[model samples]
Target: MTGTRDRLAAQLEQWANRAHAARIAAPRRRPMPAGFLRGVSYAMTNRVDSSYASPRSFETLRALAKRDVNSISIMPFAFSRTASDPEIGFIHRNPSGETDEGTVLAVVHARQVGMSAMLKPQIWLGGGAFVGEIAMDREEDWKEWFADYRRFIVHNAVVAEAGQAELFCVGTELSKTEIRDGQWRSVIAAVRLATGAPLLYASNWAAGAVRVPFWDALDAIGVDFYDPLSANPLASDAELVLGARRAYAPLARLASTHRKPVVFTEAGYPPVRGAWLTPHEEPMDRPLDPEHAGRAIAAVFAALEREPGWKGVYWWKVFSDGQPAAPGSRDHNILGRAAERVVASAYARIARAVAGAPAR
Candidate 1:
């Protein structure tokens, strides 16, 4: 796995070098339409890693395109231990997982299907703990971790640049490490050496999003917006929509303060009972509730559609293999469900109205 990862990384680096050199001589491309990004996150795990290159994933991309989705965020994973782990733990570009080659191909296919791509690289905890709790104790630990992290980001940076992805997230939700302003500034600087793509960091909403001090360094403010809008899972759409607008108002204000567009890099509710009560928390074992999921999704789009400060939103996730959500399944996947229709309708409404406006 490590050898394969190294080979892919090397290929990506060369691809990036060629791409950058060409960019230096080539004329600027025409501006894209001002369409708001109606996107869905595709989780590429080890079991489905090879699917990215398969015809099935391409078909799935086409299906999303038919739904009027204009963008897809291809999330690839790496790992670390506590925030102190000196090494990047096991860099999971495993052949069975999200390898760099597969990610690049996925990006290519997304564009082929007429959807833009955002390459979002995320770091998971080695012990399956909450990533929000990640932290380092000593100065030495910070130095070591940042060095390892730089290599990880650079690898993805090259992949995003070479793949010609529209956006690249420098990192995701690393609240503790993000507080290290000087260190993170260095990381962003190093990343720019590889990719000229617009860069952003996905900060967890509320807990970490408002606290990030490095927003000025990034091209836009990215938030994994999972703020709970209602205490009742069975809340009326009107109530949920109202609550959503209230919750998002502060985020819009923050974006205004920074003069940067805000993108909800990740956002979704589980198809489970009571999900609206604690929207950001991973779903627990419970009976399925696709109605609630549909309502929550519609509410989110409705609220954000009125907020001009927001740029785009990518729903939490949908597998590219087109897995059907079984009747009692409570996972995040919204395929073949009413929520999918809600998404399609929402995207169509905005695309028709603005021609190319982002979420506004």
Candidate 2:
């Protein structure tokens, strides 16, 4: 598995370098639509590592709505300690396997979409690991996994269709196996048949160029923004944003070439006070003051707004522990400090821009 992962990483580097060289030779930029600047964070699920059961994850949705924010992304991927575990078990099994996972996830997603519809919010659902891992060498195994993945997509599409979801991501971060596997096209077709909603695939920063070849087949480009930044203690907001834009340049070009909107499906800064926390390294360890963090987030929104062809950005999280500088600790929650307030302000700006514009 490690070897496969390393090989995939190498491939991604090659693609990124080529893309970057092309950009340097002839930089291209696209115009962003008014009202396209928006905020999205995971509000309906506990951290994947959390052992505690979430009580009414939709309540987080309610809280966000109260703040006059309406866009949200739901994660419905089944998670287990190992590969042998059932994907849907987490939602279904109580302490004693009392309820069904399908029923629970359905209710949660339904409520979120229903509420969002009332607010006129854009609703997106991530298919999670439902597609399973892409095996590099085992072609037959991939075929079988794709079969199961189709069923999973169908099931989720049924829910999204019923809930009237605005967008649904077909897959997320399955980098190693995406290139060799041709089943993503089938997955897209199945999802369209089921939901008829806009489809996207969320690729991680490391796997951006190599995975998911059918970029032209989807409605938009989805990327998870968690590139490795240096462990220095005081990385300025301007520096971070510039670094991120440079890293994301290739994806920006891809979006322009295809005339597709690009959404940062998951992007966040951890407010931890350590050099290396978790498997990823923190760019800066200073605890972000609520006021300072809010300003930093606003600056990022401004930069993204200035960038052309960019649709919007979704913060990594919204309500994890609700603590300041707590992102890298035992809690992997992406929303740290008073970042939500800044998020609300950014959304309001977008809403205003849309409202002021003449109707198309």
Candidate 3:
């Protein structure tokens, strides 16, 4: 046992030294501009082991490439029932743990497709409505939560560093705990020790993101923007675009104040009858309307095109299994839907426009 431990430690040290040497010898590449992250979020589930290695995974990658995006955010989740739980755990991954490994593989696959990768680790609160509700009343509970979260993040950070992922999200949508900026700053620092990749904290939305005082500690202002666009079930593209603009107004001011570019970590709308009325809701029983879904997506891109302060967007999701969406399914997954073409066109247009523009 002692011999095996020593051998493993030696291998890790050797790998780290090689990575450092390579980084030192490599020329500094020019930074991609603010609008560089033409991206999509790849969905991961607890049941799929070795998702990146699956045949379907590559198919999904091909589909994303058809969209002409230059980047992809690989989101893997770890769950905790509540803020008071003593530890954060991985509900996904067979045998209980492989987030770091899966993330590394996902990065490799994205790179193979000539797309930059973002390692986005998220928290899934079992049976909980949202992570925004996560909180603790006692100091001891806070300490316990941080202890577990730190270990989980640090583990993933090391993998991200080794995989050379272009970006790393320290945490996702933890609005309740995000106010503890000092502690989060420490968490960011710890992750930084293991990786040189640029980091961001993905807050729930601009409202929550603006309240996070520690944006100064990270690379970019990250928000999962799902602001209620329109309450009308059959809102037109112009109205939806206007609503998007309204949501972007305050976020633009916030980004200017901080002098940092803003990235939509996750932005999505379900293909449903009243999706425009409540952009964030996932009503399984709602009637499907691919046309409405496509319009909503186009509206988002139109607003982003007009908003210079925004940097990039990762559409909420494409599945890991690459399974075709059932005809008329009203779910949020965009795979194999008419919305996919809308996304592909938008991403292609943005990539071209950004490529031609001067860096900010």
Each candidate's TM vs. the true structure? Answer: 0.87, 0.67, 0.86
Off by over 4 Å in 3: 1-35, 45-50, 91-99
Candidate 2's C-alpha runs over 4 A off are 1-34, 43-59, 80-137, 206-211, 228-232, 273-296, 319-336, 358-360
Q: Please give the range of 10 consecutive residues that has the lowest summed lDDT in model 3.
A: 24-33
Ranking by TM-score: 1, 3, 2
The local distance difference test score of each candidate is 0.79, 0.53, 0.77
Model 2 C-alpha lDDT per residue in residues 209-284, reported as the tens digit of each score: 5356888777778776655333344556666456556666787778768888777777665544432122133334
* Candidate with the larger TM-score of 2 and 3: 3
Q: Give the C-alpha miss distance for residue 260 in model 1, angstroms.
A: 1.1
| RMSD in Å for all candidates | 6.2, 14.3, 5.0
What digit string (tens of lDDT, one per residue) describes model 1 on residues 6-79? Answer: 99999999999998888443212223225577889887644653367667788888888988988999877777
lDDT of 2: 0.53
Residue 11 lDDT in candidate 3: 100
Question: lDDT by residue for model 3 over 49-98, one digit each (tens)?
Answer: 42765556766787677679778888766788765565788643452234
The most accurate candidate by lDDT is 1
